[model samples]
Target: MSTPTGFMQYQRELPADRDPIERIKDWNEFHKHLSDEQLRTQGARCMDCGTPYCHTGMELAGSASGCPVNNLIPEWNNLIYRGLWREALDRLHKTNNFPEFTGRVCPAPCEGSCTVGLIGDPVTIKTIEHAIIERGFEEGWVVAQPPKVRTGKKVAVVGSGPAGLAAAAQLNKAGHKVTVYERADRLGGLLTYGIPTMKLEKNVVDRRVNLMREEGIEFVTNTEIGKDISRDELLKEFDAVIMCGGATKAREVEIEGRELNGIHLAMDYLNGTIKSYLDSNLEDGNYISAKDKDVIVIGGGDTGTDCVATALRHGCKSVTQFGTVGKAPLERDIINNPWPQFPNVYTLDYAQEEAKALYGEDPRAFSVLTKKFVGDANGNLKELHTVQIERTVDPETGRRIYKDIPGTEKVWPADLVFIAVGFEGPEKTLIDSFGLEQDRRTNVKAAYGKYKTNVDKVFAAGDMRRGQSLVVWAINEGREAAREVDKYLMGSSMLP
Candidate 1:
C-alpha cells in the first residue's frame, strides 16, 4: 500500500467525460482524462484493507463481486499512487491481456466490493486502470513481445470478442500458434459493432489487435466457422479449438405486429450504425436512420441505453426506453444488495446520461411491459402499446411476479423500435454443425473449470457457454479455457 491513511486522505474521483450534447454530434470517444497528479490522488484511495477482495474474482448473488481476470488491483493502485506507471502496467498486464478494453467498457465490479465502499465511496479503480494502460502506451512501454519458443501446437479460437481475444492472447503467450476466427468483416466482435463509438473508439480496438497481430496471432475475419470453414477442416488443421463465439441467439418477444417494417433487433441496429460509421463515416446510406422519427427502445441495461444514445445521435424526434423490471433503488439496499455484490442502484449510464442531456429527462421507463406493436395501413410501425405492471417478489418462493394494473395501458408514438430484450444463447448453426451438446438454457454444455466439449480437443468458453454475461467474465472464461487447451496440447500448462 502507498500510505496507511491514504483512504482517509483522498476522496474518490474520476475524469469528467466530454460534454454529452457536444459529443453526440460525432462518433469520437467521449472519455476525457485526469492529470497525472489527479490520477495519483485517486489511486491513493485504495486502502491497506486486510485480505483485499478487489481481486477475489468470484460471484456473489449471481453478480460479479471482483475483477474476473483476478487483476492485481491493490498492487497496481499502490504503484500508481507512487507514480510508478511502468510497474503498474506490468502488474496489470500480468493478468489482463487487454486492460484497455476492460478499462473502457467493463462495468467494474471490483469497486463494488472494495473495502472502502463499505463506509464511503469506492476508489476509482476503473479509471486508474484505464489511465495506467494509456500511460504505458504513451510512454512506449507497451509493445508486442512474442513467446520466445513455439510449442508447435496450433489453437483455433472462434469469436473475436473479449473472450476469444483473451484466449488467443493466452494461447499465443503459451507458444501456441493461435488463429482467431470471426464471422464479421472486422476482427473485433462486440467491440467493433455491438458497442457505440462514443463509448469505445474503434481505433483503440485496432491498436491492441494490431499488437496481437504483431505477436503472430492470425485473425481470419468475415469467415464463418460452419459455412466458410467446416468443423472437420478445423479439427484436421488446428490442434485444439476454443469456442468463444459468444451468445448470439437474440431473445425476442412474441407479440402482435412484431413483424412491422420499422421494428428491429438491438444488435442489428447497433451493428449497422457502427459498421456504417466505420466504413463510410455515415456518408453512405448503409445504416438504419432514426432521424426525425419517434424511437422506442424496449428493455434496459447497457444495450437499451446504447439504443437510446444511438437514437439521440441519429437526431430522433424523441426517445424512450422500456424495461420489464422495476427501477433500482437510489442507494444500495444493504439488506438484499449487501457488500461485495455488484450494487444494484439507479444511476444514469453514459448513454442514458447523454440521452438525458438532450431529452431533458431520463429516457428509461421501468416496470413496463410491451403489449404489442401497432402498425400503420402500409404495415410500417406506427405506435407501441404497453401496460404498466406491478413487479413484486413472492415472500416464500423468492420469485418475481408481474401483475398488470387495470386501465394502465398506454400507446407510445414510435415510428421505430429497437428490441434489446437480451440473448438466449450461442447461435445454433456452428454448434449444430460441430454436433456439440447443449444445456437446458441452449448454451454449450461444457464444464466451467473443464472447458472440454464432447470432441476431444474442442473446448468452449465465454458467453457461448455461460449465456449473456459481462465482458470481464467473458475474458475470464477465455483465459481459463486457453489454459485448459494448453494443458491438453502439452503435458502441463504454466498459464494462470
Candidate 2:
C-alpha cells in the first residue's frame, strides 16, 4: 500500500475553518483547505487495513454503514500517501463523478468505517478527497469529453438535481442523446436553490453545469413534466425516460396556529432566500428575507442550522432550534453507536458555531417538542409553546418511547417559524401517473438492483426511488440506474 512506516508515525489532521463570528457576516464557504504537505501527511496516517470496511458499501443493521458508492478508499489513501495526486484523483473519480460536492457536504461514512478509527482518530479520508479534486480542477485535468460517436438513442431526465445530473452525464458519455428537465428556472435543482450559498457556492455548481452543457447535454428549464407537458408527450418524444425528481414535499408539524403568516416551511424559506440572492442581489425579493426578525426554528437538523445561519446573516434579533431528541454525548459513545460506524457524538457545525458566537451559547434545545404556535391578531406568528420530552427505549418492543414531562413547558418569542422536520417523499403526481408502486416509506417501489417500474420503459432513481437522502447516494443511484437503462435500451451496453 502506502509508506507503511509513515502511517504509523504520523497523526491525523483536519482542515481548519474560518471563525464563526466573521463567517456569518457573509455567504461564503467557511472551510479552509490544508496545504499540499499537510494533506500528504494526513493521508500518510492511513493504516490501510487488510479488511478495509471503509469501502465495503454493504448493508449493516439494515442500513448502509460505509461508503454507499463503494469508493476505493484504501487505494486512494495509498495513492495520496505516495504523493501521487493524479492517480488518487483517477481512483476517486472511478466511482464518484463529483468529489468536490461530496468533499464539502457528505458526512463521510468511509471515515466512520475506517479500521484505523477503531482505536484512535480516523485517517483523513475526507481531506485527501478534497485536495485531490481541488488539485484536478486547478491543474486543468477536468474537462468535458463528449462521446466520439452517437448511439442514435435519446433519454429524458425529469429533474436537474444531483441524481438527474449524474444519470444525464453518464448516459451522454455513453453516446446517447440526453436532455434534463427542471421545473425551476435554473439548473442544479436543490444545489442551486434549496441549499444556501455559504455551504456550497453557486459558482461551483454553475461551473459543472456549464461543462455539462459543453458536452452537448440539453437542459430544459421551467418545464413541469405533468403540468406544462403531458407524460404521454415525454414517452413519445424520447426512447427512454429516467425519473430523478427529488423529494420536495417537506414534513410539516400539524399543531395549533400553524397557519400563521410568519410560519413557513424550511425548504420554502431556504429556496426563496437563495433564489432571491441570485436575482440582482436580493433586490427582487427572490428569497425570503429573515432580516430583523426573531426567528424560532422548530427542528435541530441541518435545515434548522441553515435557517439559523441565514437569519444571522439577515441581522435577526435572536434565533433558537427545538429538537425532539436528546443531546448526544460529548465524547464517542461506543456502547450505542459502536466503532467502525458513524459516531453520534456532539459536533459543532458551521451554523451552530456562528449561533454560539453571536448569542454566547448554542441555541439548541434538546428534548424540547413544539406544542403549538401562537399568532398575533395580524395572523403572524409571535411565539411558540414547547415541552420537554423524555425518550426511552422499550425493552420488549425494541421501539423508542417518548413521554412529555410535567412542569417543563416553555414559550419563546418568534416572528418567523420554520418547520425543518424533514421530507416525506417525491411528489405524488408523477408516481400516480406512471402507476408505479410505492414502498412503505412512500418512495417509488422497485428492487434495489431492479430499477424497473410497473410500466414499460420507465425507471426511477435518487430521492424519487430511495426517498430523502444524501447527495452522494443520489450520485450512486443515478450511475446504477443509467446502467440499467442503457441495458434496456440497447440490449447490451458499454457504460461503466
Candidate 3:
C-alpha cells in the first residue's frame, strides 16, 4: 500500500455531476472529472484489506459479490496513490479491455463488496478507474497493438456488443484474424443503440471501435448471421465461430390493447431515438417523440430508468416508472443481506435524480403491476390500469412470489407507454440455424469456463450463454471464452 494510513486520512469522493436541470436540456454525459491530485487522494483510500474481496468476482447470495473480471483493484489503487497514472492504466487494461465503458456504466459491484463498505463508504473505485483510462487516452498511451505474428487462423464473432468486442480484441491478440458481424448499422450493438447518448455517448463507443480496427479486427455492420449471411457459409469460411449475439429477445407484456399506438418495447424506442440522433440530431422525426405526452414506463431497472430520462428529455409532460418488486431498503439490513455480498440497498441513479429535479418528486412507483392498457377508439393508448402487489416467500422454494392486492386497482392517464421489463434470452434465429443446444432459459447451452457449444468449432459467451447480465460480466465472458476458443484452435492458449 502506497499510503499505509491513507484509508483513515481520506474519505470516498467522486467527481461532481452537472446540474440536473441544465443537463436534462441536452443529451450529453453529466459527469465532471476530478483533478489529478483529488483522484490520487481518493485512490489512497483503498485499505488493501487482507482478504480483499473487492475483486473476488464471486457469486454470493444469488448476486455478484465483486468485479467479475477480477480486476487488480489494489495494485491500481496503489499505483494511482503514488501518482503513477500510466502504470495504473496498464494495470487496468490487463483486466478490462474497455475501462471507459465499464467505468461509465457499471454499477460498481466491487464497491458494494469493499471491506470498508462494511463500516463506512467504499473507495471511489469507478471514478478512479475512469481517471486512469481517460488519462491514458489523453497522454496518447492507449494505442493499437496488432499482433506481430499471424497464426493463419480466422474467427467470426457474431454481435458487436461488449462481449463480441472483447472476444475479438482477445482473439486478435492471439494472432487470429477476427471479424465481428453486427446486424445493426453501427458497430456497437447495445453500447451504440440500446443505451442513450447521455449515459454512454456513441462517440466513446466509436473511439474504441476505431482503435480495434487499427489493431486488425474487422467489423462488418448491417450483417445478420442467419438472415443476411447463411450459417453454412459462415461456418465454411471461418475456422471458428463465437456466438456473442446478446440476449435481445425482450420479455413481452401481453395484455389487451397491447397493439395500440403510442406503446412500444423499450429497446425499440431507445434504438430508434439513438439512430435518429445520429442521423440528423432527431430533427428528422424518425423517432417516436414523448413531447407533451404523459409517459408510463413499465419496469424499474436501469432500462426503465433510461426510458424515464429519455422521455423527460423529449419534453414529456410527466413520467412514471413502475416496478413489480417492493422498494429496497434505504440502508443495507446486515441481518438479511450480510456484508461482503452485494448490498440490496436503494440507489438514486442519474435518471432518477434527473426525474426528481424535473418533476418535483421521484418518478418510481414500486410494487405495482400493470393489468392492461386502455386505448381510445383510434387505437392510441390513453390510460394504464394497474394493481398493487404484496410479496410473500414460498415455503417450498424460498423464492419471493407476488400476490395482487384486491380492490387496489388504479388508473393513470398515459399517452405514451414504454415496456422496459427486461430480456428473456438470445434470439432463436441464429441458435436454431446453427443447431446449438439451449438451456431451460433459452440461453445457448455452453458450460462456463469451457464456452464450447454442441457443434464443434462453435463457441458462445456473454448474454447469449449467461442470459441478460451486466456489461462487466459480458466482458469477462468474452475474455474467458476467447481463451477457450484459442485453446481449441491452437492446442493451447496463452490468454489468462
Candidate 4:
C-alpha cells in the first residue's frame, strides 16, 4: 500500500461529470478528468490486502466476480499513488492490451471485489486506470513497439472487435504475421458501431487502431470471410485461424404487430446513427430521426438506456424504457448477493442519468411486459399494449416464472420502438463456412481457456465462443486464445 492508513485517511471520490442535460445537446464525450493530485489520492485508497481478489477474474452466479482481464490493480494503484506514472502504465499494459477501451466502457467488477469495499467505498480503480492511460498518451509513452524478430508463421483473425483486436495484437507480439479481417468498412466491429459515439468516441478507437497498424499488423476492411474471401483461400494462406467475430445477431421479441414500420432492432438504430454522425454530422438525411416522436424502448439493459439517451438527443418529445424484471434493491441482499459477486444494487448509469435529467424522473418501467405493438393504417408504429407482471416460483420444477397481474393492462404511446433485448450468438455465416460445431446456445464450440475448435487449425474466442459478454471478458478470451494458437503453431508457446 502507498500508506498503511491511506484507505482510512481518504474517502472515496470521483470527478464530476458534465451536467446530463447540457451534455445531451451534443454527441461529443461528456466526461471530465480529475487533476493529477486528486487522482493520486484516489489511487492511495488501495488497501494492503495480502490476498487481493480484485484481479482474481473469476465467474460467480453467472456474472464476473472480479476483473476479467486479471489486471494487476494493486500494483498500478501503488505505482500511481507514489507518483510513478510511467511505471503504473507499464504495469497496467502488462495485462490489458487496451486499457483505454476498458477504462471507459467496462462496468468495473474490480471495484465490487475490492477488500476495501467490504468496509467502505472501493478505491476509484477505474478512474485511476483511466487516468493512468490518458497520462501515458499525453506523455507519449504509449507507442507501437514492433516485434524484434518474425516467427515466419502467419495467422488470420476474423472480426475487429475487442476480442479480434486483442488476439491480433498478442499474436503479432509473439512474432507471428497477423492479418485482421473486418466485414464492415471500418475496424473495431462492435466497438466501432454498436457502442454510441458519445460514450466511446471514434477518435479513441482510431488512435489505437492506427498504433496497431504501425506495429506491422495488417487490417483488411470491407472484406468478409466465406463471402468476399473463400474458405479455401483462408486455409491456404494462413497456418492457423482464430474466429473473433462478435455475437452480432440481435435477438427479436415475437409478439403481435411485429411487422410495423417504425419497429427496429437496437443495434441497427445505434449503428446507423453513429455512422451518419461520423459521416456527415447528421446533415445527410440517411439515418432514422427521432425528433418530435414519442419513443418506447423495449428491454431494460444498457442498450435500452442508450436508446433513451439517443432519443433525447434527437429532441424526442418523450422516452420510456420497459423492463421485464422487477427493480433491483437499493442495496445488495447479503444472503442472496454476497460480496465478490457483482453487486446487484441500484445505481443510475450514464445514459439513464441523462434521461432522468431531461424527463424529471427515471424513465424505466419495471415488471412490465409488452403484449403487442399498435400501428396506424399506414403500418407505422404508434403505440404499444402492455401489462404489469408479478414474479413467482414453480414448486415442482423450481423454475422462476412471470405472472401477469389482472386489471393492470395499459397502452403506451410510441412513435418508434427499439428492441434492445440482447443477442442470441455469433452470426452463422462464417461459422457454417468453416464447418465448426456449435453449442446449444449457438456459440462456437470451444472449451474455455483452450479455445480449440473441432476443426483442425481453427479456434474461436470472445463473443463468438462465449456468446454475448462484456468487453473485458472478450479481451481475456482473445488473449488466452492467442496463447493457445501459439502453442499449436509451434512446439510450445511463451505467450501469457
Candidate 5:
C-alpha cells in the first residue's frame, strides 16, 4: 500500500520542463526527467485510497474519469514506492501494451481522478509511469518474448496506430501469426507522422516497433486496404481481421474562402512537416512553411495546441488560437465538475505556455467563432472574420448553445490558417468496401468490449470504432478486441 504516511510526508512534484524559449528553437521534446529518488518519492505520494478511483476506468459526466486502459495504478505505485522497479513495469504491462507511448503523449486522466487530488495535489502518476518504462528499457528488462507454440491461425490488423499496435501485440502473444498493415510508409501510424517530434519523438515509437518486429510480428507499410489490396483478399488470406484504422476523416470548416491557398488541414500540415524533416531536415520544402507569417489556428484542443507549437517552431511572425467555447474555470468547480471526474479546469498546455513565453500573452482567444476567411487577389488567405459569442443554457433541454454578440465582429490578419477542429470518423472507402455497418458518427458499428462487426470474422476498435478518442482508450479497445478475436478463432482463450 506504499508507505502509509508517505502522502503526508511528501507533496506532489513533477519534472521541470526546459525553458520554453530555448525548447521552441528546436523540435525536440522539452520536458526533463526526474531522478530515480525523486520518482520514488512521487510514487510514494499515492494515498492508497480504499476506492482507488485512479484505475476505475468508469465514465463520469460523459467523459472518462480514470485510466481508460484500467492500468494497475495502485499496484505499480506501491511497487515503485517499495523500490521494486521491475515489478512495477510488469504490473504496468499487464494492462497497457505501450506505457512509453502513453507516458509521453497521454493527458494523464488518472492523475485528475487521483484520491490525493481531492485536496492538495495528485501523485505524479504520469511521470512515475514514464520513469518506470524508461527504467525497464535502460536495464534491458523489456525484451521480446515470442510465443512458444504457434496456434497456426493467422490474423491481419489494419492500421498501425495505438489500437492497431495493441491488438497486434496481444494477438501475437496468443500465438496467432500476426501481420500489421499500415497505409503510411512508416509502421507507427499517427504516432509516426500525425504527432510532432517535440511531443513524441519518432525514435521512441521506432524503438517499440523494432521490439515488436523482433517478437515475430510482421509489419507491411504503404499498403492501403481496399485500394492497394482488396478487402476480399484480406478476408480470404487471414482467419481474422481487426480493423484499427483510426478516424482520419477530418472535420473541415466549410467557409467561403476555405479554398484559399494558405488554408490546410491540421493533419496534413503536421504530417507534411514531419515527413520533410525526416527526409532531408526540411530541405525538401514539402511542408507548408509558417515562417514570417501571421498564423491563426481554428479549434482550441490538443491538435490546435500542436499546430501553434509547430508554427512557432517554423518561425511564425505571430500566432492565435480560436476557442469556440468560453474559457474554462481556473480551478475545478466542486459544484459542477466534482472530484473523481475529469476536471474541466483551465490549464496551460506546453504549446500555450511556449506561446505565452514568446509573445508575452496567451495565444488563445476564447468564446470566439470564425465566420469566414478573407483572401487576397492571389487567392491566399489574408484575414479571418470572427465574432465574439456568449454561451447560454437552454432552460428546457439544458443544452448549451452559443449566441453571437452583435457589433463584436473583428478580423485578424492571417497568412496561414490551420483547421484543427477534430475528426469525424474513419475514412469511408475501406469501411464502405467491406460493407460494414457504422454508427451515426460514421464510426464502424462495433459494440464496446465485444468489438464484433456485422460481418463475420471481422472486428473494429479504437478511433475507427469509437470516433475520435484518447490514445489510452485506443489501447484499451485494441486489447479488448484482441481478446475477443482470440475467443472467436480458438473457441476459448487465455488473453486478459
Candidate 6:
C-alpha cells in the first residue's frame, strides 16, 4: 500500500539559484541552498516508484543511463523528509564518497530516469543531495575516521583525480597504506583544476582532501612517474599500484590553422587559470587568461560550457559556442530523442544563461564545423573560418555521418579559441614506461573487473582505463579497484 501520496498528487519545487548576470561577474557558486523546511518538502515529492530506475545504473538505448554509483536515492529522500539528515547523509555516503562534488557537477542522470518525471517534473535529487552533505559538514558530523588497523600492505596510486581519491579512500579504509602521487602541485586533479570555480569551489575540494589526509591517505604532489620516479621504483616500494591518471590528452580539431598561437586545449586553459588563482589570485602567469578578447569555443559539451562561463568571468568581449551536431529540440518526446531515458533536449545551462543575459540571445551555433583558423602574420589567431553542416544516418549501417553544406562558409571574429571536442585517452609517457597494452581507443588495456595490466602488480582505473568519463564513473572505478586490491592483498575482501 502507498504510505502517503499517489501519482500526480505532489507538485515539484527546487531551491533557487543566484542571479545569472550577477553570478557571471565572479567565480563563486551561484546555487542558493534551500532552507531545511523547503528541502523536506522537496524530498516528500518522491513518489517511491516501484521500479526505481533512478539508482539502477542501467544502460538504455546504447547509452549509459541512471546513476553509475547506484546511490540509495529513495532511502535518503525519505530520511531527509523526516528531518533525519544525519541518517540521510549516512545513506548518501554509503555509495558515494563525495556527494558534494557530484551534487554540484554531475549531469544528474538520476533525475533523467526518475519515474515521477515521466508525467511531471523530476524530484530535486541533485539539490537535495547538496543540502544533505552540506548539513553533514555544518553539524560537524563529517569527521576524519582513520582506519582501526593498517594491513601492512603498501599501495601506490597514480593520478590524484576523483578516481584516484575514491580508490585511496576505500583502500585506506581496508587498512592498506595508500600513497597518492599527483603530477600537479596539489591534490584533486580535475576537481582541483579542470573544473572552473564558478561551478565547484576549490575550498570544497580542499575540505574533503583535508579529511582524507587526516584519515591517513598520504598525498605526494609535484611527482610525475617515469620522469621523477621510475615504474621499477613503484614496483619495489608498493605491493600494488593503481593508475587513475585521467584522459588528459584532448581530442583536437585538425584544421588548416590548427597550430595557431592563440588556440589552446580546454584543459590547458582551465588548468592554467585554476593554478594561477590558487597561487596568487590572477597575478600568477601560469594560466591562460580570456580577458577582453573575442572567444570562440569549439564543441558544445560541458567543457565548452565551462569555457564560456570562465571567459565571461574574465571579462571577455564576446563568447560563442559551436556544436557540430544539429541543435537539440526544446522539448523531449519529439521523436528525435525519446524519454524514459536521458532526454536529448535543449536547455540552457548556467553558462548559456549568463551569455544570454549579457548578449540577449543564446550564443550557440548548431551544425557548424570549423574549416580553418585564420591567423595573423605573427602566428596569432584572429578569426575562425567555419561552415554550416548537416548530419544524416547511413541507410546501411544506421550510423550518423556529418557533411559540410557547401556555400555556407563564413569567418567569425576570434582572438582566442578553446577546443573542447573531447579527450582521446591518457598520456603515453607512463604507458610506454610501464609497457602497458592499450586498446583501440588508446585507453589502458584491462578487463572491466580485472583492472590489472599485463604487468602482475600494476592496475588501472577511471578515464585511463575506461576512457574520458564522468566523475561518478571515476568514483565507481576507484571503489571497484580498491575492492580488487583488497582481494589481491588479503586473498579476499569484504569491501563492496
RMSD, one per candidate, in order: 1.3, 1.6, 1.2, 0.8, 1.1, 1.6
Query: What is the C-alpha local distance difference test score of each model?
Result: 0.91, 0.85, 0.93, 0.92, 0.93, 0.89
**Backbone N/Cα/C clashes per model:** 0, 4, 0, 0, 0, 1
Query: Which candidate do you rate higher for lDDT, 3 or 6?
Result: 3
**lDDT (C-alpha) at residue 367 in model 3:** 96
Model 5 over residues 1-496: C-alpha lDDT tens digits?
A: 7788888899888899999999989989988999878988888888788998998888889888899988889889889878999999999999899999999999888988999898878899999999999999999999998999899999999999999999999999999999999988888888888889999999999999999999999999989999999988999999999999999999988888899989999999999999998888899899999999999999998999999999999999999999998889999999999998999988899999999999999999999999999988989888999999999998989998988999999999999999999999999989988999999989999999899999988999999999888899999999999999999999988999
TM-score of 1: 0.98
Off by over 4 Å in 3: 394-399
lDDT of 3: 0.93
lDDT of 2: 0.85
Total backbone collisions, model 2: 4
lDDT of 1 by residue, 1-496 (tens): 7888888998888889899999888888888999999988888888867888899989999989989999999899989889889999999999998899899999999999999999899999999999999989999999998999998999999999999999999999999999999999997888887988988899999999999999999999989999999999999999999999999888898989999999999999999999889999888979999999999999897888898889888999999999988889999999999999999999999878888899788888988998889887999999888899997888989998988988999989989999999999999899999999999999999999899999778999999999999889988999999999989999789999
The sequence of per-residue lDDT tens digits that candidate 2 reaches over residues 1-496 is: 6667656688878888988888888888888888878877887777777888888876554456678888888888877767888888899989998888888778888887888788777888877888888899999988888999999999999999999999998999888999999999999988887778988998888888888999999999999888888888989999989899988889978899989889999988888888888876777876667788888888888888989889999888998888899998987777777866677789877788898998999888899988898888888888889999999888999999998999999988888888899999989988877777899988888667667877778889999998888888889889888998999998977767
Which candidate number has the best TM-score?
4
Report the Cα lDDT for candidate 6.
0.89
Q: What would the per-residue lDDT of candidate 4 be over residues 1-496, giving only the tens digit for each residue?
A: 8888999999999988999989999998878988889988988889868988899999999999889999999999999888999999999999999999999889899998998988889989999989999999999999999999999999999999999999999999999999999999999988989888888999999999999999999999999999999889999999999999999899999999989999999988888898889899989967888999999899898888888888888899988999999999998787999998889988888878888898888888999999999899999998999999999998989999999999999999989999999999989899889998999999999999999999888999999999999999999999999999999999788988
Query: Which stretches in model 4 have alpha-carbon errors above 4 Å?
Result: none
How much is 363 displaced in model 2, in angstroms? 1.3
Candidate 4 clash pair list: none
Off by over 4 Å in 2: 59-63, 393-398
Error of 3 at 430 (Å): 0.6
